[model samples]
Target: MEAKLDLPFDADKMLAGLQRWVECESPTHDAEAVNRMMAMAGRHLALMGATVETIPGRMGFGDCVRARFPHESREKGILVLAHLDTVHPVGTLAQGLPFKRVGDKAYGPGIQDMKGGTYLAVEAIGQLIKAGIPTSKPVTVLLTSDEEVGSPSTRDLIQAEAARHSVVLVPEPARPDGGVVTGRYAIARFNLRTTGRPSHAGARLGEGRSAIREMCKQIIAIEEMTTEACTFSVGLIHGGQWVNCVATHCDAEALSMAKRQEDLDAAVERMLSLKPTGNEVHLQVTRGVTRPVWEPDDKVLALHAQAEALAKRLGFALPHESSGGGSDGNFTGAMGIPTLDGLGIQGALAHTLQEHVQISSMVPRAKLFAGLLQNV
Candidate 1:
C-alpha cells in the first residue's frame, strides 16, 4: 500500500457535485433521463481540463460517457466504472420531489442508489487535480447506461474496457455503516417455459397434459439442485388460464449464484435437465438478466487490504462485508483485474422512494476515494 492514498482531498467541491447529481434524475433503460444527468456532470468535468466522449448505448434512451484524465507518469492504466441509469422510472422526478438536504442526509429518488455515488467519482478526481497528485496511469471514468437493467448492451463493453486497465475502482454506494462489499456473487437469471397440452379439468380432466404439473416438478428438481454457499431459486411462476382448465404453458424465472465458472456451468446444466413427473416436457431456457458476483482475484483482495490500511491511516476503520449481490465489479473481477468496490458514501434504502444518502459523509468519502485513486 502507498502512503499517498491517505492524503487530504478537496471536500467542499465534491459535495457540490454530489448535490448537483442528486438534483438530476436518471432511470434505468431510459436513455433520455440518463443522458440529461450525464450532460450535467460532464460540464463540470470539462472545466477540469478532462477530455470527454459519448457513446449511445444499446438501450434506446441511454448514453455512456467517458472522461479521460491523461497521466503524467508512465504506468498501466486505471478505470472507474459507474452506472448512469438508475432503478427509478421516468416519472420519479415529480414523484419524490427534487433532492433536498435534511440535516446530514440528502433525500431523492436516485441519490442513494447511484447518482450520488457516480458524482463521487468526479468529485474525487477533481480533488486529485486540486492536490496536484501525479498518478502513473491514465484515469478513465466509464459511466454506462444499462447497469440497472443487467447491462444487456453494456456488459461486453464493460468487459472489453476492463481489459485495458490494470485496476478498477467502483463507487457504488457503500454498505450501511460504511463497509464495502469485499466478495460478490456472480449471478445469471434464467427464464424457463414449459409447454404442454391443455384440457378442461371439470369436463375432460384426463384429455390434456398439464404444464403446471410438469413445471411444479421441474421447480422441485431445481430447488434440490442447491447447496448452502450457492443456491438456485424458482422466483417467478405462472401457469394456467383458469382453475377449471389444465395449463398448456408454464413460465418461471430462476436465479443462481456461483463461486466459480465450473459451479455456474454445472448449475445451469442441472436446471436444464429437470424431468417433470417422469414425462418428457418441452422446455425453453432464456436469459432474463446477468450480473457479476464479487469474486475479486488476488489483486482485488490485495487492493482491498490496501484500502483498509489506508482508511486506518486516514483515521477510520472501513471494514468490508461479503456480498451476494452483483455489480460491474463482478465483470472486472472475472477479468482477473484487481478491483475495489463500494467507495461511495454510506447510505441505505437504495432503489426506493426512501433512497437517501448521508449528506455530511460525502466529504470524507470523496477525500478517501481521491486518495485511493492517487496511489492505487
Candidate 2:
C-alpha cells in the first residue's frame, strides 16, 4: 500500500457546501428547523447516488437522517456519525453570528461545532465516488437530530445502527491543536427541587421553613463533590417570587462529569443520597441525561494509531487528545465498538458566538477523511 494517495478535495466547493449547511440553522429542540436541515442533507446524499432514509423524529426532536453507500457485501462496514442539530437556537444567525469569512476563518453558529465536520464527511464521500475508489465495506452516514441535547431521542437508534458496523468515525471537531479526540468524559444531569412552607419574612419569619435555605445547603454539598476526576456544578436554579416572603419552592439543574464510570457512579450515588439539612424542608432529585464514558480501549487506540499514520502520510502529525466534552461517539465507544472522534474539520470556539472553522484546513482534512473511508 502507498503511504499517500492522491485524493482530490476542492476547498472552494467544500466551503460553499458548508456555508449552505450553516445557513440552515437546526437547533436541537426545533423539529421544523431540523427537519428542514435534514431535507437539505438528504438531497445532497441522494445526488451522490446514496440510498437515503429519513427516520421520523421521536421524543419531540427533529428527524434523523441515514444514508448508505452500499457495497457488494451487505455485512459490517464503516459508520460515519454526525449530528444535524446544534446548540444554537433559532435566530442566532441574525444575532451578529451570520455566516461570514473574516480572513481565513469562517464564522457562523453551527460551523465549528459541527456543521463543517458534517459537510466534510459529505465531500469526502463524494470524492471517493468520483475517483471510483473501491472499498471492501460499505459506508454509512448517520446525521442525528439531538446530539447537542445528549441524543435523548436518537440514543437507541445510534446504538442499534452502530452495532451493525465494524468501525465508527465521528466528525465532531478537531481540538485547538488540530488533534483528534481519543476518549471522552461521561456526563450526567439532574433536576433538584426543594419544598417548604411560605410565610411573610417580616412578620412570620420564625414560622417559615425556607426552601432557599434548604437548597443552599444542597448546593454546597453538591459543590463539595467536585474533584480532579469528577466535577459537579449547579448550572440552573430557580426559586422565590417575592423578597418579603419566605421562599416556598426552589429548583435547580445540576451536571456531573467524570473520566470513568466508577467515578460517575460514585458521584451519582452521593447526589441521590443527599438529605435535607433544614427541618420541614423536603428535597427531591431526578436524574436526567446520562451518557456513559467513552474510554479509549485497545480497539479505539488502534484506530487512533491508524489515523495518526494516515495523517503522517499527508505530511502532518495527527495527534490525539482525550476530551472533556461528549459526543455521539461516546455511545458507540461505550457499546464496545471501535470508535474514533474528532475526524471533522479543524475549528475553534465551539458553541460560542465566535465559533468558526479554518477555511484553509477544509481540503486537507477532507482528504484525510476520504483516505480513511477508503483505507479503513
Candidate 3:
C-alpha cells in the first residue's frame, strides 16, 4: 500500500501570502529590491521554526536565504531550490501588472514566473510542520536571488549546495499542462562591442566608419547562425552618443540556446570567432555566463516517477518533458544529481505583462509539494 499524505493546504491563505511576495517586486537587476524579498522569505521561514541563514550577495546581487527544517538524520536529503528575483521591474506591479484576480486567474508581477510556486512550497512545508509530520529525509530550502540573470552570483553556491543534497526540486513555474521539467536546454550569453572612428556627421561623414552600422551587420550575421539544433538572438544593444556625430562605439548582448552540449559548444566557438567585416572597425566578443544542458538520467527519471505516482494519488496526471528554458535545476542535473523541476503552480505567459497563475492550481500543487516533502 502507498503511504498516506495529509496536506491541509488553504488556497486563500496561500494567495494572501503570495500577494505579499508579488507586491514586493524583486527584479533581478535591483539588488535592494531582491534583498527585500529575501528578507521577507527569511522571516517566513523563521516563523515556521526552520533555521534560516542569509548569505550576502556578491557582484552587486541580492542576498540568498537558506532554511533547513528540523530532521533526525544528517544524511543528504531534499534541496528545494527557488529564486526570488523576477524579470519584471519594481514599478511593474504598480503600473503594468498590478496584483488582482479575475475569474480563475491571479494576475501580478512574478506570480507565475515563480512567486506563486515559491509561496506554495513554503506553505507545503509549513503544513507538514503544523501536522507534526516528519519527512523521509531532511529538507533545505535555498532561495536564490540572481537566477533571473543566468545566476551569475549564485551559480557556485547552488552547485555546492546541490552537492550536499540528495536531490534538487526547482519550483520554477509549472508547465501549462501541469507537467514537470526533467531536462533543460543549454544556454550561453555573449557581449559584443564595436569600435569605429567618430566624426562630425555633416562635415566629415565620409571619414567616419559607423560602429552602429557595423554592429547591425554583425547582429544579422550572429542571428543568421541559428540552425535546427541551435538558435541565437541579439536582445540588447546600445550605441551612438549623438545624432550629429558618427557613432564611435556600439555594444550589444546576444543569447544562444541549444538542445545539446555539443551543439552549444559549436555555437559558442562560432560566436567567439566572429570578426568585423572591414578593417576600419574593431570588434570584440566576450563570453558571459552559461547554463549547461541538463539531460535526465535514470535517477532523475526515478524521482519523476515517484512524483508522478504522488500526483496520480491526488487525482492529477503528471506528464513531464525536456523543456527549452534554463533553471537552477540545470546546474544540479548536470552535476549528475537527480533533479526535478517546474513543480510550481501551473500558469501561462511567463515574463509577460499578462503573467498570471491559475487559482485552482494552488491547492493541488501545494499538496503535491507536501507529498514530495514527506515521502521523497
Q: Largest lDDT belongs to which candidate?
A: 3
Question: How many residue pairs clash in all the candidates, one count each?
Answer: 7, 0, 0
lDDT of candidate 2 over 255-296, digit per residue (tens): 999998999999889888888886699999988888999888
Question: Considering lDDT, where higher is better, how would the candidates rank from best to worst?
Answer: 3, 2, 1
**lDDT per residue, candidate 3, 1-376, as tens digits?**
3445656677788888899999998999999999999999999999999999999999999999999998999999999999989999989987889999999999999999888989988998888888888777899999999888899999999999999999888988899899999999999999999999999999999999999999999999999989999999999999999999999999999999999999999999999999999999999999999999999999989999999999998899999999887999899999999999999999899999999999999999888988887777
Task: Check candidate 1 and list the clashing pairs.
Answer: 31-61, 31-62, 184-293, 184-294, 185-293, 185-294, 186-293
Question: Against the true structure, whose TM-score is highest?
Answer: 3
lDDT of 1 by residue, 123-166 (tens): 77776677677654789888888876567788888888888888
- Candidate 1 least-lDDT 10 residues: 1-10
Worst 10 residues of 3 by lDDT: 1-10
TM-score of 3: 0.98
lDDT of 2: 0.89
